[model samples]
Target: MDENKSYLYDFIKGLWKENPVLVQLLGMCPTLAVTNAVENAIAMSVAVVFVLTASAIIISLIRKLIPAQVRIASYIVVIATFVTMADRYLAAFYPAQSKALGPFIPLIVVNCIILGRMEAFASKNGVFRSILDALGMSFGFAIALLLMSSFREILGNGTWLNMRVLGSWWDNWMVMILPPGAFLTLGTIVGVSRFIQTKLKKA
Candidate 1:
């Protein structure tokens, strides 16, 4: 019972306490670039989830076999293999999203979030625990991306998932969909989250 509870805590912590995007500030490339639309954000999130989870599992399974001197390189290789699979799969089935996301999907190879988790958690943990950690981190990243994309899409384009959400009378905020918009929106979210965290800590 205690073991199960610990695993649950491991999974839950990533949602807020150690969120990759919002808290850790990792993987910012896609967060700011592909988040102009909800669809793009979803696609990026799915790819990251797949890559991160698979890589964590594989790394945990082979952690002991890897030499300490070359562990980082080995982790990168493992992560890159899964990232290639995700890239090809996205391109094959979701060609539009694949094209929309461009080279960002392939760049997951160097995403600090994946490598950081592999080094900090997966490489040192058991398979089950690593899986939980990966799931938690990935979900945390997805949630942050979704929130950013949804907010930007609604205000910028008056749509959700490319579907109209606001009335025709609404004028879209052009700034909300641009590069600067991503920075501004994410800054605000991080500030608000930090403020709430401080309040909670004080209370």
Candidate 2:
């Protein structure tokens, strides 16, 4: 019972306490770039979830076998292999999203979030624990991306998931779908989250 609880905690923390995008600020490049639309956000999140989870499994399984001197390089190689698989899969089945995302898909190789998890958690944990951690982190990342994309798409295009939502009388905010919009949303979220945390702590 105690062991399972610990595992649960590991999986839960990344959703908020240690969120890769919101809390740790990792993978901001993809988070901000591909979040202009809900579809792009979902696609990017799926790829990250697949790559992060798969890489964590492999890394944990082979952690001990990797020499300490070359562990970083080894981790990159392993991460790259999974990244390639994800990139190819996306390109094959979701050509439009793949094109929309562009090199960001391939650049997953160096995403600090994945590498950081491999080094900080997966490389030192059991397979089950590592898998949980990866899932948690990826889910957290997905949440942030979704929220960001939702705000951007709805306000900018007056649509949700490319489907028109607002009435014809509504004029969309063009700025909400641009690069600056990403920064504004991210900054606001971070600020609000921090404020909430501070209040909770004071209570």
lDDT of each: 0.94, 0.93
In the range 1-203, model 2's lDDT, one tens digit per residue, is 57545988889988988888888999999988998999999999999999999999999999999999999999999999999999999899989999999999999999999999999999999999999999999999999999999989998999999899999988989988999999998998888888888898899
For candidate 2, the 10 contiguous residues with the lowest summed lDDT are: 1-10
CA displacement after TM-score superposition, residue 154 of candidate 1 (Å): 0.4
Of the candidates shown, which would achieve the greatest TM-score relative to the real structure?
Answer: 1
lDDT for each residue of candidate 1 in 1-203, tens digit (9 for 90 to 100): 57545988879888998899888999998889998999999999999999999999999999999999999999999999999999999999999999999999999999999999999999999999999999999999999999999999999999999799999999999999999999998998889988998899899
Each candidate structure's TM-score, on Cα atoms with residue i matched to residue i, is: 0.96, 0.96
Off by over 4 Å in 2: 1-5
| Clash totals in order | 0, 0
Off-target runs (Cα >4 Å) in candidate 1 are 1-5
How high is the lDDT of residue 183 in model 1?
A: 97
Residue 192 lDDT in candidate 1: 90
| Model 1, total clashes | 0
